[model samples]
Target: MLVMLTGAFGNLGMATAEALVRAGHDVRALDLDTKISRARAAELQRTAARAGINLDVRFGDIRDATYVRHAVLACDAVIHHAAILPPTTEHSPELARAINVGGTECVLRALEELRTPGRLIFPSSVSVHGPRLHERPPVTAATPTRGTDEYTRGKIACEEMIRASRVPWVITRVGVSPDPGASSVTLDTLRMLFRISPKNRIEYVHRDDVARAMAAAVTCDQALGKTLMLGGGKGCRITHYDLIQTLFDALGLGRVPFDAFGDESYYTDWMDTDEAQRLLNFQSGRFEDYQAELAARMRPIRLGLRPGRRALRWGFLSLVRPR
Candidate 1:
């Protein structure tokens, strides 16, 4: 299979590309011509080459119908992962809509114009279900979409567009994926996580698992025209407080007291991956795996920062006022 993967250099995109290569599929990779993409594409190309995989890499805007058409040419499946993510999406609605929603339109249009009956595998965020505090135990495909914020609204718009198209499609509503190897995080990201109540349930899925699910969906006959819920299963279901505390402890930063956290619910919640697992078989990671990965990634840095533990603890404490 030849898979067209949009945003082929992002955290999830890169992982998906690798997964596709490992699954014996040729990939047509497309992304914006940016410094970041330039940096990652080489790494991906090298990996693919070593694996003896055919990776057709292209750098172009997805919003351009011509560029998207060229990228989609002869691809058997399209895994559309390109989108202006949150923080940026929240601050810039026009840019977000253009890339997130508009780009998706171009992909769909390209497919329609070419009349390809290839499978469309879109990774939709679980946030589209809005704040899932007390209403549901494990969110499923049947859950109502709540476009409570700009990001979720854009995702909902794209999902709707995909559904209305004639393409064979599957939308995998993915749980939260925090990159353990990330060296740094933005203040905006911290603020968003802080807003989530300590009581809210969060399903943390490994990025590799997400990549595997999307890649596996390409050939999944039963997954065509379906919406699957994916997460790390029961072990990954945890509270926001636990999520934050685990990171703090792993990185040598002191934990924030529970009272200092917010009380309002957030979008993240446990997902019922039974249906998706039955079809895709991608839930192979546990929360403990995530924890160990994070610890290993931060070990050297944590050792260097150990001397400033008190200062870091005090600084984190001062920043933890509940929203």
Candidate 2:
């Protein structure tokens, strides 16, 4: 199978590309950087050479009509991972709309013109479900999409565009996971409140699981036109308290005061990924296990930043001595 992956050089995009090749599929990776994409393509080619797998990476933005048309027309299926997501989108609303909405429109339009039976897997976000204190667990595909953030709004709008397409498409509304790291208000506020919050349950999935689900959805005809609320299906759910405690423990930060105002709205609502499991053969492990691996990966950086952290702690102590 020939798979076209958008946002190819990104964290998730690269993971997906590598996974697809390892699964024995030829991949064409698309990214915005001409030079970087070419370099990445060479790297992938070299990596594949060592592993007996082959991948082609190209440079292109989904916003360009001509590029979208030319690129999507060549692949057997398309994984639309390209989008202007958070932190950045929160800063540049116009760029967010242009890329998230306009770029998506271009890709869907191309799919319409090509009139090919290509499978499209769009990576939507859980952010579409607006922040609410009464947020419930196991939110399903049938749940309403009411976004509170601009990033979430853009994602919902883009998904709407994808749904309007005549081509077969599967929308996976994904939750926060380690590919992006925890930069949410839930994480920050909880850390500030308690050295940990052991009660607030949160939903998340690893980037690897996300990519696997996306790749699996491509050939799974049953997944077409379906919206899947994906998460770390079984061992995926954890409390912010647990996560914070785990982080502190891993970092050996000692005891710290943690507070929780009992505001569920600060975190993402939980969801059952049964549909994702049934359709995409989803496999998600414990978030703690994912975190351990992340910690392991941070070993080199830990050495690099140890002094800075100590200095910051010292500076904080100096500022707090009843000045």
Which digits, one per residue and each the tens of the lDDT, describe model 2 over residues 28-60? 788887665677777778766776765776677
lDDT by residue (220-240, candidate 1, tens digit) is 999988999989888899889
Best by lDDT: 1
Candidates' C-alpha lDDT: 0.88, 0.72
Worst 10 contiguous positions by lDDT, candidate 1:
314-323
Give candidate 1's root-mean-square deviation (CA, Å): 1.4
* Clash totals in order: 0, 9
TM-score of 1: 0.96
Model 2 per-residue lDDT at 227: 94
**lDDT of the structure predicted as candidate 1:** 0.88
Residue 256 C-alpha lDDT in model 1: 70
